[model samples]
Target: MSVVAVLRLPLAVDLSGFVKLLQRMQVPHRVSEEAGEQVLWVPDEISEDVRSLYARFPAGDPDQQLELPASGRTSTRPGFVQQLKASPITALVLLSSLIVAAVTLLGENLETLRWLTFLEFRVVGDYIQFTPLGDSLAAGQWWRLVTPMLVHFGFLHIAMNGMWYWELGRRIEARQGGINLLGLTLLFSLVSNFAQYVFSGATLFGGLSGVLYGLLGHCWIYQLLAPNPAYHLPRGVLVMMLVWLLLCLSGLVSLIGFGEIANAAHVGGLLVGCFTGLLGGLFARRKMAL
Candidate 1:
């Protein structure tokens, strides 16, 4: 799309203004000189900002700035998610869950999958969540910590989380494995949720947010450690994450966006995710002797 800059007078500020704006926006724009027209393709976004800057011009041609992306072909989401969906991680998770469901349905005892477990609350001074039951060495009451990451809030929440999990989880799970993925999820959740309880002190926390932010953090830091802009990870996942963080932190989205966000959980998850990714990268580098 065309980014308009007010030239203040008899205007024609060549193409350099476009570059400055893109630098300001912190996104790269594709610039090309085609025919007689100078074209700049900013992401499908920042087109408005570019336009807003254009609108400031007076009634005359000033001259009219063109936003090529808005007028040209629209950009679409990266193909990475589609590629990832076809990967083994997605298939394995789906098949495993289905198999468990089928076995639960067909077993002699005939226990349903839903009966396996759910969050149970014990209201003492405040809220309490039942954690996953791991061996004593891992987490004594840890069962109380891990369950939230596995449990979804509702159908939409579950669906969205599942979509991201399947899409993102596959690449990361492939990189880290079931054990590491579970470990990150658990570690981030325990730290973030526990911190949330400490600060918010609301009690009875439940959700995948800690783990979600953990994944986001891992993706963010991973990109920096090994810039494989071409690999399985979408190049813009981290950028989109920053946008989400800005929206959440700004509270500009609270009215229309996801109503309830445990900010503490987000902060805690992000910190842990970045830390894990850094450690993971360091360990890998040492092993490879890089």
Candidate 2:
């Protein structure tokens, strides 16, 4: 747990490129002002690696000395498109949400919504009536369980959710790997959708808000427990989300014409995400200790 100083330089020098390199390499580090100089601190064990890296491409003059591989060519960091290609799970989740939103806008609206939402069953007189999604599920369409997470009610809803998904999902994919992000997304979707169904009882509801809340909770708790810079979120962002959640649950959103928020799904997703994050953080700590 001890941090060792890896490099020190003038406070005026720009260290963005070098910092980005460290981030891309997944080397945990921190920068701080120390006695009129900027100090780079890293875990004690990685000091040698950091020093070796700096020796080859000194952070003191990052622009002039480019770090070349064995081929003597500068290594290019992946761009956004390249990142999307590398993180298939993050790409798939984002694409799925976008596709659903596009289809709902272009296709038959009611039909598309019905097809993607979570199903409910009701006893109507002497027979059991199933919702569109429920009927599809009964006929072996298994995707109904998770597709609800992609369904969006309006333009604003889809846009807001899409932005959050891109931001949070990519971070998880980058830091934890694509499979971990995919697993958490699926788990959050199922839990939140089921909770919403139970709370509302046969009502139609759909959006990525639940999953966003889940991602928020995951990152929030993971940062708290593990102290990783990658999972760090601003205090203001956390406070805003919590305030919005409280407002939704307090019925203020509906009263203010924002429509009914999926309060149950939000709460459900957050609780499950926090639990998952706690377990994941503990597992990571144990692994690091070993």
Candidate 3:
């Protein structure tokens, strides 16, 4: 196969992330060391795509590293450490949820959970009363807007949401980048949280369900518009999620003793996610066309 040098960089610069990305995507490439630099070589036919990928992930990203086993060889499947390194934002969110779970005793500790809620609350005997949203905002509790995402009502709640997030979050971070994932998460949280508050009259509800739906919606629409392997989900995943959403909206899930469902939040997040995916996918498609 005819080869062409895609990039030549000083050894001090790390392209391991980029190399790993290529390997994950199964892009054919080779790395060789010259006198004082590392060179990335690829077949002439796919050099442009490799260059495009490099442009997208210069320096291999901050959280990504090229890992070698004790035998001085690369592993086909990355371990937990490597996965965590590659998706720091995802890991951070999961860790935050876990900590919140412990601190609030799975939402049983209302006093501790008050700080993370969208609105401050007071416990009155057997009832919990929430202050007006305006009161919290006026008091400069800005973090309250996004912090609710960290709160979990139960172990099962956090565990299920955490699993979905770990699966979806890493995919977004690996492809769209961490900053992109962070921005999307924040946006989804703000929109979905506010939607729930508006629709449910400031009830206490918290979980990553809304954000998970947003991530799913984003992937579904983005895959359609841009057609990238990273956004390509399994055949029934989208259907299953939508059906679950419908079940929640129908109040069937709540009837089964699953507690109150934040149907509004899920819907809000999904709408916003689809909108973002449309915008992002269109831009990506245009860029690729060019």
**Candidate No. with top lDDT:** 3
Strongest candidate by TM-score? 3
lDDT of 3 by residue, 137-250 (tens): 898999989888999998899999999999999988877889999999999999999999899986898999999999999998887887766777998988999999999999
What are the Cα lDDT values of the candidates? Answer: 0.54, 0.78, 0.87
The C-alpha stretches of model 1 lying farther than 4 A from their native spots are 1-141, 227-232
The better candidate by lDDT, 2 or 3, is 3
Residue 58 of model 3, lDDT score: 80
lDDT of 2 by residue, 65-125 (tens): 4333434456787688877776788779878878988888722376566667677445578
lDDT of 1 by residue, 188-284 (tens): 8788776676666534444566667887788667656643332236658767766877787788767686666667777888898898878776654
Q: Could you tell me every candidate's TM-score relative to the true structure?
A: 0.52, 0.71, 0.80
The reply for model 3, stretches above 4 Å from the true place, is 1-52, 56-75
Clashing residue pairs in candidate 3 are none
Candidates sorted on TM-score, descending: 3, 2, 1
